[model samples]
Target: MIGLTTYLERAQTGVWDLPAAFLPHAYFDAVVRAGGIAVLLPPQAVDDRVADRVLDTLDGLIVTGGKDVDPARYGAPAHPETDEPRRDRDAWEDALLRRAIDRELPFLGICRGAQVLNVALGGSLHQHLPELVGDRRYQLGGGAYSSAAVAVTPDTLLADVLEATPSLDVPVYHHQAIDRVADGLVVTATTADGVIEAVELPTVPFGIAVQWHPEVDSNDLRLFAALVDEAARYSAEHTARHSSRTRHPEPAR
Candidate 1:
């Protein structure tokens, strides 16, 4: 089954509430549209051992969009524009993502989730795009989504899945962007102002992160479909591995 990690939104009391965990419809819609069963993973149960256990059972990982990541994660000073930081959630997801990477599990990160993936992999963020990029129309009107056009790199995984030229209009609602890209990751897409829009780890099985919210775009089914197909393949492989070990026990290793 495909498992997607859900981030916890902090309340005023600074307590991580499990019941408060929720994800946008676009996330579920994308997963469902891709023919994968969407399983919501709790942020509270995301320690290293637990993450490893979860990864052992799952086929793919989807890190959904949420609030800004704590700057301390990427070795940066806190930006004044930063909002309520979910430290616990950060720790949990980081461990989960690390385990996923070690297992080479297919991962799809969106918006803040993309930032988290970058930071987890030794990268930094801009914190506030307006201050860093200057007069950019990142946050769309009505606090909804980004209407910016992202230029996709040719000969990239995302480009292959999208099947579009180089550029495509995407929805953006983030004020932060990837500054220093993570090691083993390549910039696959960007905005006109040079904002990092998408990143892909070429060596990995299927690791991709996008600064935009493709979930919010109903027309963007190809992206999610690709992820789901990968997940299905992973599931088949995992099941076969387990069955082989069970049926033909290795001779007294």
Candidate 2:
């Protein structure tokens, strides 16, 4: 099963209700298209042990996009541009992500989720892309979906899995982007204005984060398919490991 972590959005009165929230259709479509069972992970009963067990049982993780992350996470002062923070969801997902990484689990981060991943790994973000990148047009008219061309790196895993040309026009909807990429992560794609559009940690088996919402784009099925494929691989390996352990009891010490 692919465990997709849902972001916690703050409600009135400083409360968070993850279970009551619904994920975007595009996110569900992408997971289904990838041929994996998508499970929405709420901020429910999450602790160190629970996180470890969840990571142990899941095949892959998908961090879905939502509101802007709290600036305090990356050691930056609050910016006026920063929107309402989702502290509950942020803390839950961050813990889950850290556990997933420790177990070397494959992960895919979308939009705000990508920012969380980058920040979790000691990376920083342009709190506001337009102000930082000096591109006032970066927001794409505040639309839900905007078309932007991303130049994919040929030698990266994304380029190989995508199996497409060096550059392709992808849909983008993001106000912030990765400024200083995380350690050991390489920028795999970027926009025409030189905004970091995608990133991948080469050392990890399968870690990719894209600024664009591939889930929303019908043409971007390949991205989800790749993630599902990885999930399946992880599942098969986990099953085999468990089976082996069951069949072959440990020898007497």
Candidate 3:
């Protein structure tokens, strides 16, 4: 099963108000097309045990994009444009990400998810792109997507999955970006402006994070397919181990 993170939204589910765990259908649809069962994992208490329990059940994890990671996390002063951090999500995803790394679960992080992955691994973000880039070329307008021409770095997981495409058109939507990449991550793709569009961990068989919402494209299922393939292998191995343990019970002293 592939576990996906969700956002809390308020709605009138009843006579009164209510906050519901909400996730975009695109995430679920992408996972389904990639040959994996999708499960929505709402944020729980900031406990290691809780995080581990959730991570243990899933073969892979996809941290969806959302509000900015708390600036306090990386000890950076929040820029005027930076939105206030969602404390609940920060606590939950922080624990979830740390545990996922510990467990080595196949991880695919989206835009903000990509940022969270970087921060979780001791990296940082640019916070605001317009000031750094001097223009809004990457972002077109609100509720719309800008197209970016991406250059994939060879000898990386991204190129391997996309078959070394010299250039590819991808939907872009983000102001914050990876500033200092994490320790084990290698840059796999970028735009002409050199913004980090995709990254992967050399330590894992399938640990990838992309700034573009690959899940947004119905045709480009390569990224999700790669993750699902890795997740399937993980699930099979996990099931085999469980069966072996059950068959050969440990002797009590």
lDDT of 2 at 138: 52
- Give the alpha carbon lDDT tens digit for every residue of 87-143 in model 2: 777777888888888777888988887888899888988888778667655567556
lDDT of each: 0.84, 0.81, 0.87
Candidate 1 residues 146-194, lDDT tens each? 5888899999998888885689898888888999998888999998789
Worst 10 residues of 3 by lDDT: 7-16
Q: Clashes per prediction?
A: 1, 0, 0
Q: Give lDDT tens digits, candidate 3, residues 33-100.
A: 88999999876677999898888889999999877888888889999978887878878888888888
lDDT of 1: 0.84
Candidate that scores best on TM-score: 3
RMSD of each: 3.0, 3.2, 1.8
Residue 35 in candidate 1 has what lDDT?
86
TM-score of each: 0.92, 0.90, 0.94
